[model samples]
Target: MSWEQIIFYLFAALAVIFAFLTVTRRNAVHAALCLIFCFFFIAGTFVVLNAELLAAVQVLVYAGGVVGLMLYVIMLVRGEDASQVKQALGQKIIAAFISVLLVIQIGSIVYLSFAGKATGRLAQEMARYGNTESIGTLLYTKYIFPFEVASVLLLAAMVGAIVLAKNKLER
Candidate 1:
């Protein structure tokens, strides 16, 4: 196998592992750190796939902005709740069921791709237009509204955070 494929698999595995750890960790700080690592590895996978713009956005928006926000929120809390999360038997069963379904879905997707049934048309598109150009075209032409909405939502969240901090300082 090529080095690139090996690196891609390594990043994918680490991303999944870190994501699972992020959810399972009892310490909030550790969980948030794991989530950041997970996002970084996900962006690595995107880079391997030749979607550089997506990778940068993934790193900047998710790993930097969102994770930083989460860490800031964690810092705002006073106590360290190191206790394990306890789920009821029913909740555990439900979670296990959902996990199994997700695994099955992923397995089927991999199988189909290997069987030549899931060949994406990205190669053809990239051959016609470069990766960043195609992404920019779609983002500006097709998904402009959603993209603007996301920007606005992020701005609102930033404003809300600043206002909350000011209120706390005033109190």
Candidate 2:
């Protein structure tokens, strides 16, 4: 296999492993660290896919901004004790069933996508519009309203977080 393939698989494996650790780790801080590693590996995968803008955005938005905020919030909360809530046997069974269903669904989708025949015209059209410039142009021109809505949603989330963390009034 090529070096690119090797690197891609390495990053993919690391991303999956770190994602699993993020979910299963007992310590909250350790889980957060695992999530950071997962994000980093995902960014590496994006880089491998030749999507430089996406890779940078993944690192900046998810790894730097979101994870940094989460770490700060964790520290501010000062939650020393591990999670006390334990999953019941029924809940575990349900979770496992749901997970298996999701895995099957995703596998089917991926298999279908790769197994389908591709038209040369459609491939050419996609190539013309798949670049960062084309995507940015479409986002600004056609999807500007949705982009602004996302900004508003993020702003609302920030406000809600601040409000929730603030102390209660002395009334």
Candidate 3:
């Protein structure tokens, strides 16, 4: 394989490993640290894919902003409250099923792309308008609603995290 492909695979593997570690860790701080590493690896993959803007955003937004905020929330949580929660058996089974489905979906997507079933339309657009411009155009035009919704959802999540932390502090 080419150097780029090798680097991409390496980044992808590390990202997956860190993500799995993030989910499986019992300690919230350790999980958050794993998540940060996962985000960094994902950013590396984006860089290998020639999407530098996405790589930067992944680092800045996820690794820097979101995970930092998560760490604060985790710290604000009382040790007893955090330690008392445990994953149910049903939750584990459901998570495993979802993981299997995601693996199958990803495998199918990779197969289709390798088989040349994936459309070249996106590549054509990227070539013509350039990566950042095309992404901006699509995000502001076609996918504006979803983009706005996502922002609002993120805001809600931040608010919820703060509220939960405050509640824990009060107790």
Candidate 4:
């Protein structure tokens, strides 16, 4: 196999393993760390797919900013004991079933979408304009309003989080 294929497989394996750990880990801090690794591996996959802008943004925005914020929150909310939390058998079974179904649905959709013609078209488009410049131009020109809206949403979320974390009673 080619180096690209090998790298892709490696990143995909790491991403899947870390994502599973993120969901299943008992400790909240450990889960957050696992999620960071998952994000890193996903960034690697984006790099392998020649999406340098996306890879950089993934690492900067998700791995660095978001994870740092999450770690800070986790530290602030540290509990004396986390092991005492218990999950019911029925809840576990239901969660597992939902996870399995969601995975199967996603796999089916991906498989069907990229089975033949769609893959060729995607490749063609990527080859034509899969660079930072094209993405920036599109974002600023065509999708400017949506981009601004997303920034507003993020700002609102941050404000809400800070409000929720404050100890003072609101009058």
Candidate 5:
């Protein structure tokens, strides 16, 4: 196999391992750090795919910005609030069912998208202006609204975290 394929497989495996650690860790800070590494692996995949802009954004936005925000929120959480909350058996069963459904849904969607894809204009565009420039143009023009909305949503989450921290402190 090629070196690129080997690197891709390595990155994918590390990403999954990090993601599992992120979700399963008891400490919020540790989990957040694991998640940051997971994001780094995803960024590495973007680089392997020749989408340099996406890789940079993955590092900057997800690894740097979002993870920084998560660390800040985790720091704000009080010790008592950090205690593990035990889930009931029913809740665990429901969560497992939902997860299975989500996996099935995502698998079908991916299969359908691959099976139905016909056009290949993307290669032509990439040949002309390159991936980064094309992404920047499209993101600025067509996806501007969603970009703004995402920023607003993040702002709301930050505010909510602060509010929760404040409430915990007041009690």
Candidate 6:
């Protein structure tokens, strides 16, 4: 295979490995760290796919913002409380079954795309204006309302969280 393909496979494998580790780790901090590594590798895969904007967002929004927030929350929890949170055997079995199905679905999608079945309006737009431009055009034109609604919802949630936390602090 070519260098780009090799690098893409490397990143993909590492991303999968770290993602699995993230779920399987007993320690919360280690799981968070594994999740960050998985995000970084996913970003690398995006870079390899020539989606630089997506790569940057993956690193900044997920690896930097979300994982950092998760780490801080993990630290705030007492060790015993965190350790006591456990899944029953039946839950673990169901989760593993669901995970296997999800993996199979993803693998099929990747196979089909690589086998050249991926084509449509989005592909045309991507080829025309490129990744970032096409994404921006679609986001602003087609999905503007939903985008704005999500932003407003997020803002409301943040305000609610702050109010609740402040009330708890006052007690």
* lDDT by residue (tens digit), candidate 5, 1-171: 778778888999999999989877878788889999999998897767777788898899998998898888678665325747775679768987999999999999989878866433456658879888888888899999999999999899889978976745654
Off by over 4 Å in 2: 84-90, 116-132
lDDT of 3 by residue, 20-102 (tens): 99888878898999999999999998877768779988899999998998888678764324755666899889989998999
Model 2 over residues 85-115: C-alpha lDDT tens digits?
6746797689879999999999999888887
Clashing pairs in 1: none
Better of 4 and 5 by lDDT: 4
Candidate 1, position 29, lDDT: 89
Candidate 4: tens digits of C-alpha lDDT, residues 101-136: 999999999888877542123455677766787899
Q: In model 3, state the lDDT of residue 99.
A: 87
The TM-score values for the models, in the order shown, are: 0.74, 0.78, 0.68, 0.83, 0.70, 0.76
Candidate with the larger lDDT of 2 and 6: 6
Name the regions of candidate 1 deviating beyond 4 angstroms.
82-90, 109-114, 117-129, 155-171
Which candidate number has the best TM-score? 4
Clashing pairs in 4: none
Pairs in clash, predicted candidate 6: none
Give the count of colliding residue pairs in each prediction: 0, 0, 0, 0, 0, 0
lDDT scores in order: 0.84, 0.82, 0.84, 0.86, 0.83, 0.84
TM-score of 3: 0.68
Ranking by TM-score: 4, 2, 6, 1, 5, 3
lDDT of 2: 0.82
Error of 5 at 18 (Å): 1.2
Listed per candidate, the RMSD to the true structure in angstroms reads 3.7, 3.7, 4.7, 2.7, 4.5, 3.8
Against the hidden true structure, what lDDT does model 4 obtain?
0.86
- With candidate 1 superimposed using the best TM-score fit, by how many Å does residue 137's alpha carbon deviate from the native? 3.0
